[model samples]
Target: MRFDTVIIGGGLAGMACGIRLAEAGQRCAIVSQGQSAIHFSSGSFDLLGRLPDGTPVTDPVAGIAALAESAPAHPYSVIGAERCARHAETAAELLRSAGIRVAGDSRRNHFRITPMGKAKRTWLTIDGYLTTDDADRLPFKTVCIVNVEGFLDFYPEFIAEEFRKRGVECRFGSFNHPDLEQIRRNPSEMRSANIARVFDRDADLEALAAELHRCSEGCDALILPALIGINRNDSLELLRARVGCPIHLLPTLPPSIPGIRAQQALQHRFRALGGEYFLGDSVLSAETRGSRVERIYTANHGNIPFEAAHFVLATGSFFSKGLLATPDRIVEPVFGADTEFVPSRSEWYTLRFFDRQAYQAFGVKTDPALRVIKEGKALDNLYCAGAGLAGFHPVQEECGAGVSLLSALHVAETILKIEN
Candidate 1:
């Protein structure tokens, strides 16, 4: 089971990385346990539109600029207006390649591209004040963000207050959590995994539909917690059919996510091109010496090892245990025994709470190249992208798939360029 690259997580970053690497004629595969995170995605990407210094953002350039200075250890720290534009251009190119169209908004963003490649000038704002316009206009009257219950990731009071302060009509949907006691009492596959499993099943999950019907009673659209109970096509169908509103899915934050299928949807093209899928596969360990990584190990039926001239660690964060956020949550432990990770602490969760709530979940701590870094050290042969990287909160702002794609593309380009 050798490959040019062995990506750890099956989420957005790993899938996207695998796709591009495979498309570049590199043999790539990803191993993972659960589904991806984008399944519960609202599917709308955006930026916070402000800097840590409180500078209001009129464009992506400024927002990215702020990210650089603040997030010196995460993602890119040098993305200026021009580079941001370059990012947008690169994203448009990638989208076009992916058979999707994405344009900027005439109201807020500078340009607009769609999956369909339609071009239109437009304006967008929380209120009808002509706040911002972009080259591409946003569709729908309200931008709905979905959150789940019991998860308690996003505090209801704070979110509702923020929306109220902004005068935006935000709605929520009810998702079931592991009533572990109740479930243990009535052990069944459907009830074993909580709401996420419920959404994936066709029958017996009707309780979720009933609850969704209740929570989404009169809201224009119901934004649900990340893919936990995300029915994808069915969710959109049911919400549209029963709730009668534009359903926008906000991807659930890391560690436990339900968007694996969404990643599959986006990765279908690459797989169709002959990419090998090692679903439920994993990396046991890697044997590396010096700056080069020689081989890695895994186990399915027997001991499986993979050899690669080059490698990419799109595995993910402590939650996903890519970088081992804590003791209980660990990953392959790249580098060696001395490579320690974040301390185990419940309080590691920041105070603002909502501050860490969004889909990106604080992102990953990386350098400009989007390589995961601990103490100013970039994990050689290891590059990171997506929610795992710490920087601007994508959940709080508009996480244009562009950011992840941009970092992923840039890293891949640099890797391929350097390797050749």
Candidate 2:
């Protein structure tokens, strides 16, 4: 099959790009091999939370400007602060249009409390996770953290203790799901996802809400693990309607329901805009002529070949298998794009676990236009975005979603400009 654009990787970057291109009336296809790294996302979009020197960033717009002046090779630097700001606005517009309402803005960031009781500064967060005021205000009195009986990841007591350390009047509460008896029979199946699956039913949710309504009375606000529902907005609305109070969600480890919902919303909008999506398939290889990619071959039922006028490489970094680390070298798997890495593997890591690791900064090297470069030459029709792009440690810098979102829109905008 042929399309105007073929995006590899069905993560946030690819989905964002596909949505924008499809909205612009381009034929687009997104190839995916099951779940994306988004399932592990905190459901918050972080721009630049810290400087390379480990300084916390309060104003992301100002941080980007400073970063552009200092680190010219950083992805945001190459993309430019002006374009990055514009792309952020465009990204917010597209996400809202796609039914994912986000809270926060581009100018300042909010230090959102994590399930681990630590705070992460982020640019935009999904609306359901924030307080009703939409400000970075914490519930001062009668704050309750709800823990599911069998959920291993979220510890309400630990979270409450942490909050107490910060002088917040926090309390912990636990509720045993009626369906817990069924899952307790199989210890292995008692995961957050399985529990969420059980909660997907309105009847199950209503029961839980009744329990919460009793437990949550006189509480100023209820902080729960993000397991309210997998459909996020719908589940949040349902829970709000039934429970009736201010609700804040804390991100738990892995299989993130909020992230899943965001991806689903983007995918839904992409398809609604006439884009094709091939899940449980991966781009195995590609055909390239000179600097232009001709087509890509996926590991479909018949080794399907997909041709596109433009190809986007959002396959992500080592975590997503976009880049492979070997005993000898770090290599880009599919397109063999040049990777920005230290030559010696010995320099890849530091002695202390708390210290920053060099390997985390390893990824693809992209030109200013966000095009993939191989052996010092930019590919004509190939673009790169997301974790695959080198120059920033996503965890340390807190710019994963920011880079993905902005770069995706930037790539789409670049393609549209060239076409125009």
Candidate 3:
């Protein structure tokens, strides 16, 4: 089937871009595998209305946020932060309208104690959002934080100490893995969703539960990661029924399932709007002739022959790594496309994983028009968005999904020339 747009990589950026283009009345098809990367998402959308240079704005939308970025000439000019914030709100509203009500507001969310009084860092809550607060002064006798097996993040010690400092007794447990040593020796300070990645593979749930049991043995309240299992609703109902303690779910970061749920919600909306889906597809590369896309090749699939259309590549960075092709150590994954990326990985992430700056860390080099550039030249018909476009720190302002959606919307605006 010939699609007006064939978007590869079904993760956040890809999903966002595809949904936007499809909603813009373009015939679009999204190619993806089963794992949407939504499985690991925390689900809260960040909509900060101000840019980093402190440029004042109204409110954040779903696909974009407001932020100050450095253009070639200016020293830190404001750009996508507002755009990102805006996108988040729109997408979230779409979710709420779908009956899975999500919460967001112009007001900044606050941090608070978990029901288990685990992590010292406060959490945020809107009306439909998960409610959390600083548990420092709260008199909770026994509270527990959950963990998982082989999961490379979640700090039991850090959380325990924080609760201790706050004068609250707390317990740290693992829903990720059972091995204390494995959880203890996680080298990656940032959490990995490896266990969650394998959630639907028909593994032993009882064993998984036994491991959770091992971690939660003496806890009164069990604080598990949000989107605890493969099935969101089922996980909520099942775990609540099975676990004896008071069950509370907390939001997680990138590779978050909530992000994926946002994606799914968008996809359903897109399809309802007559968008086509091409699951598990690969476009070999673009065949261009004289500053225009000629045709797209696919191995064992079909071809996308384009004469004069634009393309948005939201292939994410190393974590999602759709843009990273690992062939014989040659590096770069997006076919033979040259990326005007940071010189090295050192510039990509800050040393501190907990630092919010690292998450919005990387993507493609492009102009303000969202065009991918290499040596001062645009890639003709191609544009980049999402985490694949580079250089916005998502963790810093919690703007990952917002950026993904906004830039895609920006691409749509360019495609449609929506003059605001």
Candidate 4:
């Protein structure tokens, strides 16, 4: 198998890079191992939500500029704020092109209502999800949080409690149809995805609309757990139209329907542009010729090698096994790429659970051009992006999505420039 580029992970970063390259008439292939961290998304993308000093960011463009100065070794710093801003715009347009309708802007950060009802700063939110320009003020004065009867994942009462604290009139309600009764019987199986499957039917959706109307009386808007649209936004749009009042979705627990839908949509767009997607496949080893990668062998296609001019490592952090930690050191398994980590393992994590941990910042070392370094030499054709690159704490700084997206675009732009 041969392609112009081969991406080793099919998460947001890999998909973004693949889509960008494919759109430019490059043959791209993405090898994915099951699901990515997108399954745990909150239906929002973050672009420098907080500075390294833990200051909440209001404007992301300014935030990037500050981030570049404070965290000089960070990926955004390496790309520079000017290019990061450009990539941010391109990333938004790319999502729209892939059928993912998002609200908010890279220039400013909006407060997205989390599942716990707390406001978290983010860059781009899915269109149906609730977001506010001001964290202290909500758009609707009165709201009713509705959840499925037996779904334990969504806590309508908790959300209502939080809303009430904000001086808003809040109510909690639940409605279940006969179609969902069977799935509701099994406590474990009644997840957002399964409920969404039942809601996919027109009749079920109509019933839900009627139920929401009943529960939403005297309320300015209705807030429902995101369980209606698994594949597309049409179901949520139809429900909102049928309900006759403003309806907003709150992302449920992990395996988020909106995130999965976005992933599927992006993959579909890549395939439409003549890109190949290999899901449930793992890259086992690579064949390197000095500083350039020649081919990579996968677990499924044992002996068959995927040959490409450029290779990307977006396999993610320790969560996805992109960077592994042994007793003595951190290692990038596939290509034996050099990693950035403290020599002492004792400094990996702090004693406080909520405190920033050092291990989160540990990842593969890369050059200013985003090329991976192996044994003190940068690989000519191997680039690293997303959570795999070193130099910043994602959770603490709140820039995971930004790094994933902008770094992918930066690497893609570099590859395109080299191609030209």
* TM-score, one value per model: 0.59, 0.95, 0.65, 0.99
Model 3: per-residue Cα lDDT over 277-359, one tens digit each: 65655555676666545456554465544333666666665666655533222123544455544455555456876654432
Q: Global CA lDDT of candidate 2, please?
A: 0.84
Higher-TM-score candidate of 1 and 3: 3
RMSD of 1: 8.9
lDDT of 1 by residue, 12-65 (tens): 666666677777888776666555545443333444444454455566555665
The lDDT values for all models are 0.50, 0.84, 0.52, 0.92
Clash count, predicted structure 3:
70
lDDT of 2 by residue, 226-343 (tens): 8867754477777778888877888888778778888889899999999999999988889999999999998883566899889999998888888899997889889988999999
Ranking by lDDT: 4, 2, 3, 1
The TM-score leader among the candidates is 4
Misplaced by over 4 Å in model 4 are none
Query: Higher lDDT: candidate 2 or 3?
Result: 2
Q: Kindly give the stretch of ten consecutive residues in candidate 3 with the minimal lDDT sum.
A: 69-78
Worst 10 residues of 4 by lDDT: 228-237
User: By lDDT, who's the top model here?
Assistant: 4
lDDT for model 4, please: 0.92
